[model samples]
Target: MATAKKKIHYAWWTLVALCIIVGLAKGALNSSAGLFIPGATQELDILTGNLTLYFSISSIVTMIFLPIGGKILAKYDIRSVLIVAIILQAGSFVAFGFSNSVWGWYIFSIPLAVGGVFTTVIVGPVLVNQWFKKKNGMALGIMGAAGGLLGAIAQPIVGHTIANDGWRAGYISLGIAIIIIVVPTVLLLVRKSPQAIGLKPYGADTASAVGSDGAKEELDKGITLAIARKSSAFYSLFLFFLLITSIASFAIHIPSYIQSRGYDVSFAGNAMGAYMIGVLLGALVLGFLVDKIGSRNTVYLAMVLAIIAVLALLLATDSKMVITLATGLFGFTVSNSVGTLAPALTTSLFGSREYSQIYSTASLGLAIAGIIALPAYGYVFDFTGSYTPVLYVILVLLILNIILVTFAFRGKKKLLTQGHWN
Candidate 1:
C-alpha cells in the first residue's frame, strides 16, 4: 500500500518560530525589567521613583511609535524589520549595563521602546492572524504559553544573576544572548504571509471555498476601520486595553512590593517564577476557553479570577505562602488580559479588516497605561510606604473591565445591525 505522507503545514513552523522569537523578546528581556530595580537603585544611589521613571519615558516613546511601527510592519519585509528591532531592543539593554546614572536608562529607553513596539506589541498577533484561519486563539495562546515558560526559566536565572553578579552583568549578558538567538530565528523562519510561500493559511480550506481567490476574499471580510472607529465597540476596546494594561503594569512593582512587605529578594525571585508558571497555565486555559466559550465569556472568567487574586492579596498579606499563591494567581489573570485575551477580544469585536491599524491605534491605551501606572506605583510606594492603595485601585479596574467587555460585545451587535460588518 503506497499511501502518501501528507506534509506538515508550514504555518505550524511559522508558529514555532514566532513562539521562540516573541517568547525571548517578552520573557527574557521585557519581563526581566523589574528584577533589576533593587540592585540598580541600591548600587547607584538612585531613588526608586526616579529609577523607574525611565519606564514612563519608554512608554512615551512607545505611544508615539505604535501607529508608525504598525505601518512599517505592514510595508516592510518581516524578517528585516524584526532583525533591526531585536538589535535596537537588546542593544539598549546592553547600554543599560554601562549606565551608572538614571539618565542613561532614560536616554536608551527610546530605542528600547521603539523596537519593542514591533517585537512585543504587533508581531505575534499580526503573524498569527496571517497564518491561522482557524485556531488562531489557540495559536496566540501557545505563543503566550511559550513566553510564560521561557519567563519562568528566565526569571529565576536572571534573579540569581543579578543577586550574584550584579545588575550590570545581568543586563549585558542577557541582552547579548537574546540578540544572538533572535536574529537567526527571524531570518530563517519568519515570513510576511502564507501566500509568500504559495500556501494558504492554516485551516484556510475549512474556512472558505477551495481556491486562492476565495481564500483572499474570505480573508478580507469584516468592518472597515473607518466605520469601526465610529462604533462603541472600538471605544470600549480602547478602554479595555487601557485598563488591562494599567493592571498588568503592576507586575513591575511586584518585586518592590515584596521587599516592602519584609520579604527578601530571593523570595521575590521565587514568587516571580511562580507568577510565570501561572502565566503559562493561564495562557493555555484562556486560549482553549476563547475557542470553546468565546472571548467575552473567557474574559468574564478571567476578571473573576483577578477579583479573587486581589482580595487575597489585600486580606492575606501575613502568610508568605498565601502571598506566593496569590501572586501566581495574579500572574494568571494579568497574562490572560495582556497577552492572550486582548488580541482575541480585538479579533472577535472588530474582525480582521484593518486589524493592524485598528489594533495599533487602540493600543495607545497600553502606552498611556505604562506611562502612568508604573511610575504612579513607584511614587505611591515612595510616599505611603505601601502598595495597598494600588491593590484597591486594581480591584476597581477589574470590575470595570467586566462592564466594558459587555459593552464591547453590545457595540459589536450594533455594528452587525447596521450592516457595517461585511
Candidate 2:
C-alpha cells in the first residue's frame, strides 16, 4: 500500500497558498492605508489626530484580543476562520468607503482587529510551523517577501485607484477583491496539518527517529507561553518586538511625513514604493543569510542597516536620491522584524510544544506597538512642527533593539545550560 500510493509534498503547495493569501491580504490592506488616510480625513472633515485614532483603536483591539484569537484558533477550522477573518478585515476596509460618521469607523475597527489577527498576524507562522520542519526561517522570510512583492505590485495600483477612482470606489473595489482572491485559495489549499495529506514534516523520516540509547527520539519543542512569560528573555524579546514594530508602523506615516517635509504628495507615494521594494530585497537576503550565518548575527547586520536608513531620512529628506536610498535600506532592515525573530527565537529557546500559543502571546507586542507608535509619530509632527524628534526617537529604539536581542539570546544560552529552560 505504501509503495502503491503516490507521494506528493504539501509544503511547496502550502508556500504557494501563503504567497497568495498573505500577498493579497497585506499588499492590498496595509499598502492602501496611506491612500485612505487623506480621503477619510477630507471627506469626513475629521482631524488627522482623530482619524489616526481609528487605526490605534484597531490595534488596541488586536492587542487586547490576540490571546483570545489564539485560543479561538486552537478550537476552530483555519479555513473557516480565514474566510471570516478576510471578510471582517477587508470588509471593514470597504465599510470605510460608506462611512459617514467617525462612529462608523470606531465600531468597525472592532471586527477589523479581530479579523486581522487571524489573517495577517497568526496565520503564516502557525501554518508554516505545521508544514515545514526544516528551513522554517526561510519559509517565514518568503512569506514576508511575498508581501513585499505584492506591495510593490499593489501600492502603485492603489495609488492610481485613489488618484483616478476616488477613495471610496478604490476601497470598495480592493476590499471585495481581497475576499474574492483569498477565500478560494484558503478553501482549496489550506489544511491545518500535514497529516491531513498523509505525511510527516518535510525532513522527518522515521529512520532518523531512533536515538543512540535505543529509545525513540522526539522533536524538541518551544518554551511554553507560561514559562516564556516569566523570563528576562521574553521581556527582552518583547522590547525587540516593540522597537521593530515602531519602525514599521512608522511606515504608515511616511507619505504624510514626506508631505510635511515640503515635498510633493507624488514624491511621498513614490518613496513608499521605494521603501517596500527595499523591504522585499532585505527579507529575501536576511532569510537566506539567517540559515547560513545564524539568527542573532543576522539581526545585528539588519539593525545597522536600519539605523543608517533612519539617519539618512533625518539628514537627507530634501534629496530624492538619498531619501530613496534610506527608505529602501530601512525597509530591508525592518522587513526582518516579522520575518526572522519570533519563530527563530522561539524555536531557539524552547522547541515547538506550545509554539502557536507562545508566539501568539508574544505577538501582543506587535498589536500594542501599533497602537502606541502610529499616532505618537503623527502627533509628534502635529505638535512639534516637524518629524525630526520622532526620527531621533526611532534611532534610539533601533540601537536599543540591538541590545535587547543580544541579551535575549544570551539569557537563552544560560537557560539552556542551567537546565532551567529549553
Candidate 3:
C-alpha cells in the first residue's frame, strides 16, 4: 500500500506567527488608540492638538531608536527581543488606563516607542526577507492583510468598550489581553532566521546563491549601505517613505474626521471597519500585483487609487455612502504604503544584501513623518477647524511621490551602468 504524505512549509508557520504578533500590536493596540483620544480629551479637558503631542514625542523616540534597534535585532534572539517588546508596548497601554495628566502619555510614550520600533517598524520586513526568497511581496501583503483583519475586529470592539466602560477600562483590558496572548506565541514560534533552525530560506533549493555570501564570490548583487546612502535613489526613497507616511497618518485621524462631519462615534467605528476591510483587500491585491508587475508598477497603481479616494472624500462630503467608500478606498490603497511598499521598494532598489541596515536607515523617514505630519495635521485642524487643508496637502504629496518613483529607478539604472549592482 502507498501512503500519502502531508507537507507544510515551516516558513508559512513563521509568517502566521508574525501575522498574530504584529496584528495585535498594530491592528489592535495602535489602530485603536485613536478611539481613545476623544474620550481621553473630553474627560481630562485637554485640547486635541495638545494631546496629540504625545504622538509626536513617540515618533521622536522611534527616530532615535530605529538604527540602534536594527543592530539589537541582528544581535539578540528574536524570542527574547519580542517578548520584551510586547511587554513595553502593551504595558504602556495598561498604564494609560491610570493616566489623568497628558504628561503620563509623554512619559509612557518613551517605552512605547522604544518597543514599537522593533515590533511595528523593523521586525516584519527583516524576518520576511530572510525567510521567503520567493513570494516575498506576497508575504508582506499577507502580513498587512492580517493586520487589517485583526484591526477590523478590534476597532469596533474598542469603540464599543470605550462607549460603555470608558477609556480607562478599555485601555487596561485590551492591553492585558494582548500581552497574555502574544507572549506565549513569541516564546514558542518566532526565530531570527531560517539558518537558526538548520534550514535554508523558503525556495532556497531553486533560487540564486546571491544571498549565501560565499567567500570566493567576486562581486555582490546588492549595493552596500555606504553606497546606498551616497546615491540619489536613497533620498528619493526616503521622500517616498516620508510622503506616504504623512499621507497615511490620516488614518489615525479618521474617527475625528468623521465626527467633524457631524457623524457619531458608532458611524466612525463602522467607517474604520470598512477601512480595515480595504486594507485587507488592498494588501493582498498589491502584494500579488508587485509579484506580477513589479514594485514600480504597483506603486503607480496605488497612487492612482489614492487620488480617486481623496477626490471622493472632497467632492462627495454629503453622502454617507461616498464617505465610507472613500475612507475604505483610502485604507485599501494608501495604508499599506508603509507596510508593503516601503520594504518592497528597498528590495527592488538595492537588493537584499544589506537589507536590514539600509531599510532601517531609510525608514527614518517613517519616524520623521510621525513626528512632523501626525501633529501637523492635528494642529492644522485645530487652527482652521477643518481637515480640508490637510487633504489638499496629501494630494500634492501623492503626485510628488509618482515623480520621485521615476527618479529613483533612473538612479538605479545609473548604479547598474556604474557596475555597482554586480
Candidate 4:
C-alpha cells in the first residue's frame, strides 16, 4: 500500500468560530454581572446583602448541574445544546429587565446558570479538546481571553447604560444583544468535533502531535470518582480553587468597592475593564508558560504573583494609580482560578476520559465560595461599613492557595510513580 497524505480540514475553522461565540457570550454576562449590583439593590428596595444572594443561587445551580451539563454535552449535538443554552442565559438576562421582585432573580438564575455552565464553563475546553489535539492550552487561553476582551467592551457600556437609561435598559439591551450575536455565529459555524466531521484533530498533520506520539504519556487514565475522592491531592486542589476563587470573586465587588472609596461609577467601571485586561494578559502568558515549562512551575509563578497582587490591593486601594495597578494585578492572579489552574490541574490529576466529571466535581468549590464569601462581604460592610475585612480574607486565601498547589504537584508525581499513569 502506498503511504497516504493528509489534507487540511474545516474543523479548525469550526473551533475558531465556537471560540468567538462562546467567548462573547461569556464575556458579556460574567464580566458585566458586577455592573448590575448597585441598581438591583437600589431599585428593589432590598438590602444589598439580599440582592447579592442571586449570585449564590446561580452558583448553586451551576454546581449541581455541572455534571449533568457535561453528560449532556457529550451525548447531544453541540449546535442544539448551544442554542438552548444561549437562549436560557441571554433570554433570562433580558427577563431581568422586567423583574421587579427579587424572586425573579432567584428563580431565573437557575436557567441562566445552567446555560452558563454549557456556554462559559464547559463549552470552550470541551470544544477545544475535540478540535485541536495540540496547542490546546493556547486555544483555551485565547478562549478565556474572549471574556476579558468582551468585558473590556461591556464594563464601560454597562456603566454608561445604567448611568443614562438605568440598569433595566442595560440588562435588557445586553441580554438581547448577546443572544442576537451568539446564536447566528454558533448555528452557522460550530461543528461538534474533528471526528464528527470526518477529520483528524487540528495540527495533527505536519505538527508536533504526530512527532510526539511515540512517547505519548498515558493520556486517558481516569481514576474513578471514588478513588480520586480518597486522594489528599484532591482536597489540596479543591482548597486551591476555593481560596483562589474567593480572591477572584472580588472582581464582582470591585464596582461597589470603588464607589465606597469615593470613586465615581464611570471610573469604577473603567477600573473593572482594566482589571479584565490584566486577566487577558495573565491568562495568555501563564498558559504559554504551562505549555513550555510544565503546569507545575506555571502554578507557582501564578501563586506568587497573586500574593504580591493581594498585598498591593490591601495597601494601594486609596490611590488612583495604585488602585488600578493593584486591582489589575489581582485580575492577573485570580483568573487562574477559572482560566488556567482548573483545566491544567484536572488533566494533570485525572487525565482526559473523566475530565469533565472531575473538573465539575472540583468546581463546587467555586459555588461554596460564593455561598460563603458573597454574603460575608455584604455582612462585613453592614457591620464595619468597609471592605477591609474582605481584603484581609482574600490575602489569606491566596497564601493558602500556594500551599495547595505545591501539594497537588507532589501528589501527581506520586501517582505517576505508582503506575496509575502508565
Clashes of each: 0, 6, 0, 0
- Candidate 3 yields a Cα-based lDDT of 0.86
**lDDT of model 1 at position 48:** 82
Q: Quote each prediction's TM-score.
A: 0.85, 0.83, 0.86, 0.86
As for candidate 2, its clashing pairs are: 221-351, 221-352, 222-350, 222-351, 222-352, 223-350
Estimate the Cα RMSD of every predicted model relative to the unseen true structure.
3.5, 3.8, 3.5, 3.8
Runs of candidate 2 exceeding 4 Å displacement: 1-11, 67-77, 133-137, 191-234, 264-266, 346-362, 406-422
Ranking by lDDT: 1, 3, 2, 4
Query: lDDT tens string, model 2, 1-422?
Result: 79654555788789889988887777668665865666666678876666777789988887778779988887998889899999999999889889888787789888888898887878888888888877676787788888888877777677667667777887888899888999999988998888977778765663345333433223444466777778888888877777788877878877677767776545665677777787788778876777798778888888888888888999887799998788778778785666565557666655676766777677778767888888777677667867799888888988998899888988777667766544
Residue 216 in candidate 3 has what lDDT? 25
Residue-level lDDT tens digits of model 4 in 1-422:
23343544575566667666776776677777777777777778766667678888888888789879999999998899999999999888888889998888888888899998988878887878777767776677677776677777777777888778888998899999888888888878888877766788877765653565444544556565666666777788787777767777778888888778887767777777778788778878777787798776777777778778767766776788877777677777677556686678777776775676777788778678877777667767767878888888877776777778788878767766766653
- What TM-score does model 1 achieve against the real structure? 0.85
Give the winner by TM-score: 1 or 4. 4
> Considering summed lDDT, which 10 consecutive residues are worst modelled in model 1?
1-10
lDDT of candidate 3 over 147-209, digit per residue (tens): 999988888787777777888998999999999999999878888789888888888765675
lDDT of each prediction vs. the true structure?
0.88, 0.77, 0.86, 0.76
Q: For candidate 4, what is the TM-score?
A: 0.86
The better-scoring model by lDDT among 3 and 4 is 3
